[model samples]
Target: MNLFRLDASILPGNSASAQLADAAEAEWTAAHPQGTVTRRHLGTDPLPADAWALATTASFTPEADRSPEQREALALATALAEELRSADTAILAVPLYNYGVSQHFKTWADLVIAGSDNPTEPLLKSTPTVLATTLGGGYGPGTPREGWDHSTPYLERLLGDIWQAELTVVKRELTLAATNPAMESLRPLAEDHHTQALTAAREAGRALAGI
Candidate 1:
């Protein structure tokens, strides 16, 4: 079982999103002790800003007329898509940054789609996917920030709507409560949410691997 794990978090070891992802990945690694896992730290190794542009241009231009840079961009996009193509499962760990999806992640997704759009492709056709996310605050109905979370739902659209992956999501909210003085009162709730998210992530990883 090939596992393609991608994490897009600028906070490094301090990222709550990474913690949930680590929990899930731990279960996956245990279940696939002999299976290979590919890791992409997208925040640190973001795709070039022009990757999507070059990829799209290369797709439209004749092979004979493609520039060397355009050809390289296409190749890079293909390699990125191949990570998903070769994987049986994936963990896409993302964080809600300023109430929106990570720029690095958006760029990566666009480039992958540009390079791989065939409906018959294996990767975009029901590969099991786990979306791990962390949000700085609560966004439940009636909450002050009810409509603030845009990243998690965007990921849902990309994986389920666009890519057609069988998806599961595990997220931890109020992540800033632990570190922000203004949110101190919510710290206990944050801890509870973290525990629950980790538990769900572990269970999802194990169950999906079994299937």
Candidate 2:
């Protein structure tokens, strides 16, 4: 089995999202000892800014009239698409920024998800996907903050549409509130939801790997 791990955290070090992704990778490696792991760090190595422009041009340009820029863009897009298509399982470490996935992730999403009008040419067809998200606040399906949760549902819908994959979301939120000693002392009843979520995520990773 081959796993593609995408790390989207913008932070340089000790990022919660990156840590979670590493945890998931570790679990997967443990389960599939011989499996190869491919890592892509979007924060450190971003796609070129003109990638979209080149893709759009290539989409419209005739083969004979296509410029070098357009050719390069199309080539890049094709490479990215091929990588995603070849992966057996994909683990995305998504950190919520302003209630949504980071812009870098969104750009990567655009590159991978082929948006053609043809119904048969969907981007990722039946690829397994796992989304691990870290947020400053807690929000989920039916909670009061659900309306503000732009990350999970949007990603779920997008990935489902493209890949037709089984989507699972493991969220860790409000770590500061949950782990702070002073807050724990003052609010003894405060739920350690972040820790629970992390534990759940680790188990989920193992389960996904069929361990």
Candidate 3:
């Protein structure tokens, strides 16, 4: 099985999203000891700033009439699409940035969702995908910041709504509770949430391995 993994957490060692993703990847590796895994660090190697605009323009222009610039743009999008098309299973690790999606993730996801110039072929295929996300604050219903997680809804639209991929979301919330003095009272709960998230991630990883 081929596994494609995307990491979008800017925080390196301290990123909860990355941590959970690592756990998931480990499980996949264990199950498929000889399988190949492709890793893309969106936080560090983001899609070029101009990639989306170029690709969008390319999508509209006829292949014969498209300029070299447009062709170049379309190629990038095709490459991203191929990654998803070729993968048997994929993992997307995204940390909620400022209560919303990361700019890097948005750019890459946009290109991946936007297909190549071919009208007949779909851009992204439905692959089993694991979404590992982290929220610095709690956003569950009845919480102070309820309904504040803008990232989750948009991600659902992209992975579940747009790509039609089988998705399992493993999230760790209240990551800042243990460190932020203001949220000290919630530290115990935060620890529990972290433990649960790790277990879920590992289980999801193992399950994906079987698929």
Candidate 4:
């Protein structure tokens, strides 16, 4: 079994999303002791800026007429595609930024989603995806900005559209400790959510591992 951990947190140790991802990885490791796990920290090692340029160029360029720059660009896209293709399960940790995913996460998504001619093949097919997200304010299934919850919804759509993969979302909202005293007092609540998310991730991993 193979698992890929994509961490998109930008705030170093202070990132709640990254914490959840770590917990998820730990849970998965414990559940499947024999499985192989690979970690990709987009916050630290981001995709090259030329990824977009390569994608765009590849879209129009013929194989024989491609320039060296175009080839490098295609190579990067292919590399990201191969990573996703090789993984049986993927764990994505994304923190909400203004009700949306961080740019780092979006770039990673772009790389994975761009290489496929169908836009969904590389992401949704047989792979299972677990999404862990943290939000500064409360907004979920029925909330006001729920429609605008660019992180969860977009992820669900992308995974479903591309790979037909089953997706499980574990979201923690209203986590701005400074602004919301109630949120600040909900450390236990957040911890509970984290635990639940890890449990869910483990179950997802086990299922994917055929255990």
TM-score of each: 0.95, 0.84, 0.92, 0.83
Per-candidate clashes, comma-separated: 0, 1, 0, 5
Cα lDDT tens digits for candidate 2, 1-211: 9888888888848677776667777788888999987778888998887776776668778988999988888777777777766788778888889988888888777766432433234455666667887876657566567789788778887777656666667777764555666545423322466566677678768866877
Better of 2 and 3 by TM-score: 3
TM-score between model 3 and native: 0.92
Please report, in order, the local distance difference test score of every candidate based on alpha carbons. Answer: 0.85, 0.72, 0.86, 0.73
Give the Cα-based TM-score of candidate 1 against the true structure.
Answer: 0.95
Measure candidate 1: CA RMSD.
Answer: 1.6
Q: Candidate 2's C-alpha lDDT?
A: 0.72
lDDT of 4 by residue, 5-71 (tens): 8888887678877766666666667778898987888888888876866776776888888888778
- Per-residue lDDT over 1-211 for candidate 1, one digit per residue giving the tens place of the 0 to 100 score: 8888999999787878888888888888888889988999987787899888998889999999999999999999889888888888888889999899877888898888777865334465678888999898999788899998998888888788877888999988998888899999889988999889989999988866873
Name model 2 segments beyond 4 Å from true.
Answer: 114-124, 140-146, 176-191
What lDDT is reached at residue 63 by model 4? 89
Q: What lDDT tens digits, residue by residue, belong to model 3 across residues 1-211?
A: 8999999988776788999999999999998999999889987777788888888887878899988877887788888888887889989999999999988888887777555444334334567788999999999989999999999998877787667678899999999998899999999999999999999999999988984
Clashing pairs in 1: none
